[model samples]
Target chain A: MALKGNLSDFSIIQLLNLITLAKKTGALYIESSSKSARLIFREGKLVYATAGMDAMPLIKIMARSKLIPSSMAASLSERYRSLNDMELGITLINSGYLTQDQIFTGITDFFKDIIRGLFTLTDGLFHFEAEEPPPLTSIPLRMTLEDIIIEGSRQAHEHEDLKSEIPSLDVALKFAERPGVNIRDINLNAEEWRVISYVSPKNSIKQIAVVAKLNDFQIRRVVYNLLQAGLVELIRLNNPAAPAPPRMIPARNPVEQRNLVNRVIDRIKTI
Target chain B: MQTQTVKIVVTGPFNAGKTELIRSVSEIEVVNTEKKVTSESEKVKNSTTVAMDFGRITVDNDLVLFLFGTPGQKRFDFMWEILSEGMLGFIVLVDSTRPETFREARGILETFRAYAPTPYIVVANKQDLTDAWSLEDIRVALRLDSAIKLLPCTAKKKSSVKTVLLELLYAILEELDSAKS
Candidate 1:
């Protein structure tokens, strides 16, 4: 049976960590509304990855990496279009057009880029088919997943912080009423300025993101930076019903609460 | 003689040893609503808590403490909100050996925090395992606040469970003291 779950329940970082720790060989397939990706792991190490229907061919990657010339890459791709990535790589090596190290390094970087792009996907359905082999048309390289996991973890932390700071994109942004620092004194980048132009009480952060072509992370990050600089403030268009505050000890008396806690402490110490 | 009950919730992701923590410390037999693992994804354990786990400790003739463990799966998140009501404090348990659950643990922590402004501590359980992550790494993975206490714990051990409870009680005491001043 395959392991299946929503990305919201088990994030990509968690899935990678689990696979690495369990040393499971599998192919993880993830699909969102607009995109799909497949990552192949052999004995818990990443071997291959392809995003969408068409993955950038291995020869193109090698040429882009300066391992081979673009003209040679085009000719080789046309000549060996019938061959799989691994076969083409072997052909290149045997023909003295590329070395084993060059092919491996080039393909490894390409795989890393695909994985990094996958990290940005927040919502998707994923399934891992155990012992499933990589497609014969792809190159498989033995690459440890630790570095990618660490990088993904860092990004996840930053994303969480940004989400916490700006819990909703529906909230609009307005210029600070009392700007302690002059807007002119602070230097803003072109993207920041573009976002600023869209800042209004009527325009929500989500609306600005759509107009500016920024994703959730990008908009949240820009808003967070602006808020931190005291250049903007969030204005809620609709008042959200607040959750009930946590009920502390029912006893309103501080002394009673203290006594109760102390007693519990003493009892727990003995146990 | 009069007795009062103080509720402290124990919650975490599935298989994070929440039941073990309560069983190790509860004076009475724990009242658990655990069901068999029907889902293939959760086959790591034979059973999973469906509703909640209830346990108690007698703190002398006048005071008692109640420990409620919430179900670990997200489908039962409503139980977390219900179990967290009118509590003195709470404990979040994490399976130290499983980094995959760290993200789930963070989500649980955030939900509980949203429910109330109460004192809480994070317990890194299964510390006895050779592959257990260090407290610092767990701290980073969970992005826990520096002020929040992250204690090493072996939930199966009575002493370790007691220490975790004591630390939480101490935090509660400190909060009450601060409120008084």
Candidate 2:
């Protein structure tokens, strides 16, 4: 038998807490309007997680995080496309390309990413089955559900802060010119510098996220911090009266529209 | 002469072949953010694009076209808006077999028209399928205007995809020439 309920009836945090307290091992399946994912737990600890097609793969995430070159990640995916998630992780580890610590850290971040991605869902179906999930290959990842719940709450609060500062990730951003500020005085980390390199008035935060390989939340946080320090500025390009593309001819006249279609059809027949 | 780069957005509803169109036409490897389908969409395809698909192709030596494919679901419309910015033109690829998707494509087209008033064409994709609607039938079903260009294409065929691209390019070039005058 499986335990199931709407998220409205029982919040994800409370549900996970109850599972943690009871130390039940099972898999939790969550489904929303446009997204769904599964979290595999062992003795109340999350050992693995996977989501619907809207979510990128762990290999893509790793490449985005700069942990591995995108080419290497692509090759790994092509070579292990058929392997299950845990099996692929084990293969990568056995191949000596990834350390066990790296996989553990990666899996942990993946859990948080899924949690954060679906944190805003107030209504969704969840099924918790007390079945033994496939073993996580050689390295077992055991994450404290309580810690994840707490971290999720914290990030939700940060998301609220970002919501007010940045209108939308679609808004274009550009580096602000500083007349008096010394460049060397401000200590910039490599990731921050990399984010800076992609900033342009033409590139929206979403585009920057793609090039930077970071998730939207991570990129937005960087931009927020940069804005507060007067290092970047937002460009508003909302034009309500932008011209519509010129029509070939008015289609209101049925005779003219029919004639145009007929001529095109005749030309196509000849071709 | 300066290289003129045109950003064209390829969009439509679920399983409309936006990603396949870009993949078939792009010179560069398409960068896609797709994951396994786990919802009602699973009935349509195994995987769905979550973010956007990106590719590039050079046209006529001087024109470099950047192709961006929007996620099919309306939930990811924010990405569509983002991709539509400064785009020269766009193509809405509809799956002819699914009338519901044609409706979905219409909604997307309306939303995109309001966002970016660029020239667009209605691409009836998956035409190789026996059940696919004819161009005339699709036009009537979509309630498409005579002014809009409707092209039937098999998204998987590179030559067919290239033809669609060429037609869109001609439309865009016409729009650009008129804008200058």
Candidate 3:
């Protein structure tokens, strides 16, 4: 029904490559028939991605949440049809139906779930291989496994702490995903995956973070990377657990971990 | 030879001296409006540059600079690239007073940083203020890219401001020189 060379026709890796080559700084919004997808770019590096519908009706469910007027909801829904969520949020905020923070929050949640859903729908199999360097001469960006683990460990622990507060992982599982090669190549220390494994649940991110005793921001990222590589599906208990990404076993102590963050920060400062 | 004029943009966080720098250099007519913004149900984007500020300076009546200032707040950030297209380079004015702003500045910088590695200069503006930080201090605090040149300037002074702009042009010239090699 569509031309072959358009953005949707490209494979995930192809999409990533296109993004790198263009080095354009804009969000890419892609929809396939009934479904929609969004990816954000900062310069050449791929920062964020999402796929699936924004559950618009849930905003009315919050106990203390103000009841959104049917008129406003209907109007905003119309806007989403015409614009991507980022634009939609801005429009709705400008229209005074939603606050900027409110919409930003919605966008954040929407991206997370959309990303989770992205895991199940993705078809392309190519991924960053750990043992072997990415089959390219130049590195696309510095989002390597170390960054992943640092991000992942924090998330895993958050899941453990927030488990009971939110729904289970089943709802959290949305995006179609695959594992990146870095997970397999880097040897994760015991502490890292131990936290990651705990939060690999079938509900909301809260469940995994609470159960794993981890950080929310970091957990979201670990799960995000896992989903990217197709290692896990967003569907709750839809499939078996993914083999945790490789990490340097015998986890580093907290002191050592602090040093790593400092080291990375130091390197960036020098740059 | 016909003189060519190029538009150069000055942008970054609030109080990055975008307006002051423009006033110090342009031979005539510059506009600046200061407003204190309030928050609402949404994150109130405090930096209000509601419109583009224009300043003109004829360089040897050739290589003229048409300076455009953009809103520094995040909500208005979308206008950056739209304003930056086909420009020779941009001067990212840095406020040495507020270190917390460097992170926000970096975020903004990363969005537009495609090439011309030296197409920017870290003008540590407002250097003449009391208890003001030094250029190297701002440099380390901002975790600025090691590759770019850092300049200290008090945009309130014409010579100091012009010197910074000249340095930025030289940086571009140096990059162009290297590219030729």
Candidate 4:
């Protein structure tokens, strides 16, 4: 069965832990407003990873790392255009252009980079398709996710802290009333200034993220700092459709409610 | 003599075994409106409740308890508000073996809280499974308040179901007692 959830509810650390503990073979697809990533696993170990619509080809990665001459890389790319990444890597190793260790190292580093970038995303949707095969065009590796999970745990904790402070991205921000500190006296960074420019009760933190070209974690961090400094305050937009607090009991009188509950308890005890 | 009825809601994420929980304890046949699951993502279960599951127990000749299980999908969230009206208490069930649904369970709990300030308990179902998360881990993952009761349960067992109901009833009784004095 497929497993899916929002990142806000399950952090990447938890997801990796589950994958490792369960020894699951699957492709975990993660997507946010700005980017999407796919990490394929075999028997709970990461095998391959690709981010965005256009991932850099293996040959480019190899040549960029100076393991192979750029001229040879261009020639190989044209000659092996029809071959998938795995096939091309094999051909390169067989042709003595690059060592097996060199190819594996280059792909492993690429996978790490993609996964590390994913750690910074605090909000997104993730779906795990069990037993799904890796892409034919991608070069697969067999690296344990333990190291990556250990590294990402700290970021996950920071994300959790930020999330607790500002629970919802739907919440808008506005300048605090009666600021304890002068706005002019406080120093704000470029990103913070950009976020401040979009501060309005009409614009949600999510909208600000898009306009300011900041990711979920980045935007939340800046807004959190602004809040801590008393430069801004959260504005919960009026949701007229939100459910009203329910009456304590269908019965109107507190005495009646108490008696009713006592009777139910008595009945339940008999069951 | 007129019969007095009280409503109690059983809610959680999709496939947390709401139907089985009610079936284990409901004296009357549960009136369920379930449909074959058409969504690819939810095909883990062959069918899902589209509307609601209604069960009843006769406390006595004069008192009856109505158990309403809300549908588990996001599309049916509106029904949660409708079914939660005037509920004396609630039970939030989580499939302990599947951590993926914990977030959805938290969302359901938050929605119910917004609708009412009633007493509720979170049940970690499927505890019989070897892979089921410990109650402590589930509680921390869901970020439940320390005071909130986190009970282990296997929904198919009548005794297990009874324990959950009794705990909820006790919580309700305690809430009422607090209100009185």
Candidate 5:
């Protein structure tokens, strides 16, 4: 029987467990207006996964993490594009650029990032279509579902904790030094310092995401880490709903107030 | 003269038509953060507003109305408090056919009152539905104050939604007049 239902009714995590435990081969499709994702399984193990444009570039992340040189990663991507059937990891291994262990580690980190994003989706429609054998991406990484789900769950929990501390994604951020400390004295990695340079009290988290050319989740994670390290501060905008402290001087006389109300009522009558 | 922007908060229990009311009356395309309904929320609506819904209408050259629709689920209760901050007034929409949600509607009313203490009206929505409760019945079930106006409106109709806003503005004017005296 084909399995189809809302993610709310059956969580993605639980769905993954079911498919893996059953040792089934198929593709699971999940869609929401904001995002769509797919997970392919072969003999109950997750083989490939993708999520819209948010499927982050593994090479970029690897370069940022200092796992490989940016120039080398870019060159490898160009070379991989030219090949017809050669897989990226195999190509890198054959060229002696990265060892097999390094390629596998990079794959695990890349897939983990995508899985973490999928777990944040609380609402979406999902369906499982059985197949004789699942389709594979150019360089599909084979990993145990057990390990992926466990690590994804840990990342999901950490995401929730960060959200609690950084409540509104709309809140603005700015660089702030702790009391009696020199800002220049603090050590910062190239990426962390680059993100901090864009921090302005006027720039909301959403704006920061754009300026930094990173997705919302990645930018939020960076901001949360910076906050924990005492290198940044979140600026909560004054609630626009709060009643203004009684006006020092009335803006209008009673007659003016009445006239304004009348005009407003008259205009709404036409609506 | 300065153009006065008035912020009005629309709040209610799940599936009470807060989004519909704003969509009906807003002049501009509304900005809403809605996602597929998951968990227990699926028992009601197919999708739910997560963050907030925003819309705007100009009520003459000098005055503008900003409508904010708060998320319904209790998990988003913090959002209710956040959106209601600095609101000049609020509207509590109760689904006339869903009496079970009246308790939640009352709780939303109380939360807004605690935060703003401003003029408000209870909108008895879905009046077009045959199974909907009468205005008086809704008033009693919600235990509304006599001074509080109970307005029967079908949130999907533009005219009906406008009437609700007019009544709310009238109530605000009355409060201001009384305060001045």
Candidate 6:
């Protein structure tokens, strides 16, 4: 039950429960472009966690060894404001509140769990890039680079199909060279975006045909547009039956439902 | 590039427990001005940030987060454009206690579909109330998208709160995966 993947795939909370379900114990290292967090679990329970920024003290210690304005860190510490834990450490270092070493001290002091890998599960690093307004840093953590690769690979794979399906889509994607495609100007509408988002190699034309509410020819046209944009990778599905799960859900009676609402309202009024 | 910061707005139409959910799991005290929210101000409150609450939680100290709760009223819908854009994802709260909340719930649901369709989770809050509504019932009432995972929740409980947040993060990441593929 304790599965592993990028932070882009699972949230820490759900991952914990999955681990809790399996009663697993291991170290999970989750990374994105800027930083990494490691969670250590012992028999399904969390013990400690830390991130690459935990190495900041090592950075500050190095920066001080290099004399990169020790006061620069102290001055910026006061102006930093954010709700993210990992960002605080970065903000400190970038804002000049603490030298890379000072913030690293703060990170290790608080993020010791991340550095120690106390969790009993091992999850891969996510490689997500954060776009924000902030100052720059001199020395980056070693783990951050690995994440960037994973995320980049992830992006490249998603849009491969539409690129191949529609030659036009291929051109736009190559020309644009960005994650999102602008079918808005191309008369493709939002429904097209829905279909475009699902053009993975795992899904075939038929599977998409069922969900898209669009015909195969229409889908191909949309896929063609996507192909020109390099937004998807159209492929054939080997397991057509693997698509939709059965609807074990029961149908409801309209009168029973409205009656229930009325009774709940009456009860509330009485209250 | 560096680690990305996810600025998430957890909102729904009125009476959806947006504040309660925040209160349950927030490591820091969540600022709540609950009195500012009610049936009367539903028309013109156009986003007072009633509980424009703030909190922090460290996860292995790698993920930095900013949690925002917006009032769930049609009037406040305007602020959604500002809050939804640039957000990592969203967790939409659904009120299980009152069925009438569906109209507003549907409005926000459509907003998410039309605007912030990336990765989002739906929470069926107030599982503790007497005559508790079933999960299936809430889903049907809300007519939620099949892909959206709606977890039964009593935002006051730590376990419930934690699971909801986890599912929410999962949804966002999954959306990223879909986009990547």
Instruction: Please give the range of 10 consecutive residues that has the lowest summed lDDT in model 2 chain A.
Output: A246-255
Model 4, span A198-253: residue lDDT tens: 99999999999999998777888999999889999998876447555554444468
Which candidate gets the maximum DockQ versus the true structure?
4
Q: Regarding TM-score, does 3 or 4 come out ahead?
A: 4
TM-score of the second chain for every model: 0.96, 0.91, 0.84, 0.98, 0.94, 0.83
lDDT of 3 at B179: 59
Tell me which of candidates 1 and 2 scores higher on TM-score: 1
lDDT (CA) per prediction: 0.85, 0.74, 0.54, 0.86, 0.75, 0.53
Which residue segments of model 5 deviate by more than 4 Å?
A1-260
Writing each residue's lDDT as its tens digit, candidate 3 over A1-271 gives: 0101232223333334434444435555555544666555555454444453233332332112444665556554555565644555456668776676664444344444554344333232222211222213211232212333234345445554544433244446443344545455755545346445654344565676667654444455566555545555555544556533322112334354333333322322322
- Name the weakest run of 10 consecutive residues (lDDT summed) in model 4 chain B: B131-140
The CAPRI-style docking tier of model 6 reads incorrect
- Write the residue-wise lDDT of candidate 4 on B2-33 in tens digits: 88889999999999999999999899999999
Q: Is candidate 3 or candidate 6 better by TM-score?
A: 3
Question: Candidate 5 lDDT, tens digit per residue, A1-271?
Answer: 4356566545567567667666768888889767787777788887766676344455555565567898887886676675532365566678787777776677666666666767766568877777834343345667777886677667667766777777676888776656235566767776576688878887888787777766555677888778877778888886546543322222446676667667767878888
For residues B19-108, write the lDDT of model 5, one tens digit per residue. 999999899988999899878744687888989889998987779879999988877887776687666679999988776677679888
DockQ, per-model, please? 0.23, 0.03, 0.01, 0.27, 0.11, 0.02
In candidate 5, position B145 carries an lDDT of 66
Question: Residue by residue across B16-133, what tens digits does model 2's lDDT show?
Answer: 9999999987878999998998887546788999999998876545556688999998778767777888776789999877655665788899988878787889999988886676
Lowest lDDT 10-mer window, candidate 3 chain A? A1-10
Which lDDT value does model 1 have at A114? 80
Give candidate 3's error at residue A57 in angstroms: 58
Which window of ten consecutive residues has the lowest lDDT sum in model 4 chain A? Answer: A242-251
What's the lDDT of the predicted structure labeled candidate 5? 0.75
Badly placed stretches (over 4 Å) of model 6 are A1-271, B1-4, B32-51, B60-62
Greater TM-score among 4 and 5 belongs to: 4
The order of the candidates by TM-score, greatest first, is: 1, 4, 5, 3, 2, 6
Clashing pairs counted in every model: 0, 2, 65, 0, 5, 58
> Can you give the lDDT of residue B154 in candidate 2?
92
